[model samples]
Target: MRTTHAHPIAAALAGLALLATLSGCAGSTAARSDAAAGGPAAPVPAAAGAAAADEKAASTSEGTAYAAPGASERQLARTAKLTLVIPDPAKAAKELRGVAEGLGGYLLNENVVTEQKDGYYVEPSTVTVAVPGTKLDDALDALSKIGEVRNRNVGSVDVTTDMVDLEARIASLRASIARVQGLMDKAGTITEIAQVEKELTSRQSELESMLSKQKALAGRVAMAPVTVTLRPPSVVIQDPNPLWQGLTAGWAGLLQSLRMLLTIAGALLPFVVLGVLIWLPIRVWRRRRRPNAPGLLASVLAPATVDAEDVPAAKPLDAPRDRPTTVDG
Candidate 1:
């Protein structure tokens, strides 16, 4: 009976040990998997490491945020406007185009205007071109040799911050897209797969937009825009003598007065012709009626003649005979 009791106790003890061993192995395996998946197995260390990484990234980004004072790494978009008075605007414009091409640039736009000046056709040109940002000063210098610069303006804009922001966002979107793709691969249901795919598509679209903006911004920083306005040299007449100046002024005034009078006459010519055309017909009509008018006037003004027996004979002495009979009575 003691042997039987010992056997049962030993079996129970062995089973318990085996169960404990199994539990330990499972716990270790789970802990390793959680660590590999960056799960909550070691939350405190992971959090600390993440914080350190974030601080490091922030410090590095801040350090490289801007270029040094004179460094060329700074992204700048440069533009210049120049007004030049040259002898021949057309020729100058052609030369300017060649200059831009020589400097590895291209013309963006050109407008040539032909105007009449002093009985001569003058062609003035306005040209816009782009050149390498580094060669902007050189281009300006070369252009200055083409003509006398009457006006000049140079401007610059910094886009480093925008470029940096775009780059960061693009990187983030790429990582997010990759993570979503992984999730899609692991998805068990159609709904989860569709949702992951939709998220991926959205992120990809955002990434593409950011890339486009970045490319445009980079192009602007790489090239500088220049606008050149070329005009013909003005003619200046110099007369030092006061008498000659006075005579010239008087002649100019007389010519201006004559021009004004001619302009007034030209404006009135049509109205005057219209008035004469209307008056001539009326005058002709009145002349035709005047021949009949005289007869009507004669009929109205002539004295009327009375018939011979129409007048009664005047009484001669009847009044005197009546007065004498009254006196005798």
Candidate 2:
């Protein structure tokens, strides 16, 4: 009976040992496989080390800021200022307005001015058009056909990074607002609730401001503005007939001379009137002093008389003759 008990105990002990060894082997195998698949298992560091690493990563990412790095979704604000020589600016303006309307665009403003050229009035118009960004190229192409381009300036600004950063900031603010609101709802005290509400309002306002900015940026990106200035052709045709040319030239010269004379007369009229007012009394006083004054017209045309002293006097001819006669007798 003692031998059987001893044998049972020994077998039991061996089985327990065997089971422990198998479990150890399985654990080792799993560790080895994990090590092979992933990198070697590092000894777990203290919590402080992990925290520092996280902080470093956050700082690096924040410091690097956001960049649009060759992305397919690019935001560009396109604008163009163009000057062109069209045969007729009024007609061109009309056609351009039609084109803009056809392209689901509109003319923001327009002005047409008639200028004199080669004895004819040439109309030059300036128009500002707002069009969908997608149709900007098409509109430019069509407008180009209407005239010879005198000046063309096209520009684009990349706003991808700005837009992305704004979106991220807005999302973060919204999340903050939500969190604050949740805290407000769960607050146990009036003070806590008030504090949470204050923070929530701040974050909400910030979110709204960011959203407004986003809308503005999107508006610029969605539509493009183009300012087109249409000028008449540089060289204008003239009348070949000499008589007609001479007549027009004479007429222009005459009109210009008349205009200049009228300007001069207008400018001098004030001074002339002032002079008459001041001089009339002075003239009247001088005439009273003289008592033998000529009329205004006679005074203007009369030749000045020399005084007797100013003229050399003739010698005393009678005294000379008396002396000469006595001498001769």
Best by lDDT: 1
Give a tens-digit lDDT track for model 2, residues 149-237.
88888888988777766654543344334333434434555554555566657656766776677777777777788899988766655
RMSD score of candidate 2 (Å):
20.2
**Candidate 1 per-residue C-alpha lDDT over 1-329 given as tens digits, one digit per residue, 9 for 90 to 100:** 44433433333223322322332233344233323433322122444335434643553464343321123357888999999987666788899999999999999999877676784446667999999999999999998889998998999999877776665554444433443444444455555555556666766677678667777887887789999998887767775899988999999999999999999999999999999999999999998978788888999999998987998887776554454435555
The Cα local distance difference test for each model comes to 0.67, 0.64
Q: What is the Cα-based lDDT of residue 66 in candidate 2?
A: 32
User: What would the TM-scores of all predictions be?
Assistant: 0.54, 0.50
Clash pairs, model 2 backbone:
none
Candidate 1 segments exceeding 4 Å error:
1-72, 119-124, 235-302, 307-329
Residues forming the 10-long window of minimal summed lDDT in candidate 2:
35-44
Q: After superposition, how far is residue 57 of candidate 1 from its true place, in Å?
A: 18
- Judging by TM-score against the true structure, name the best candidate: 1
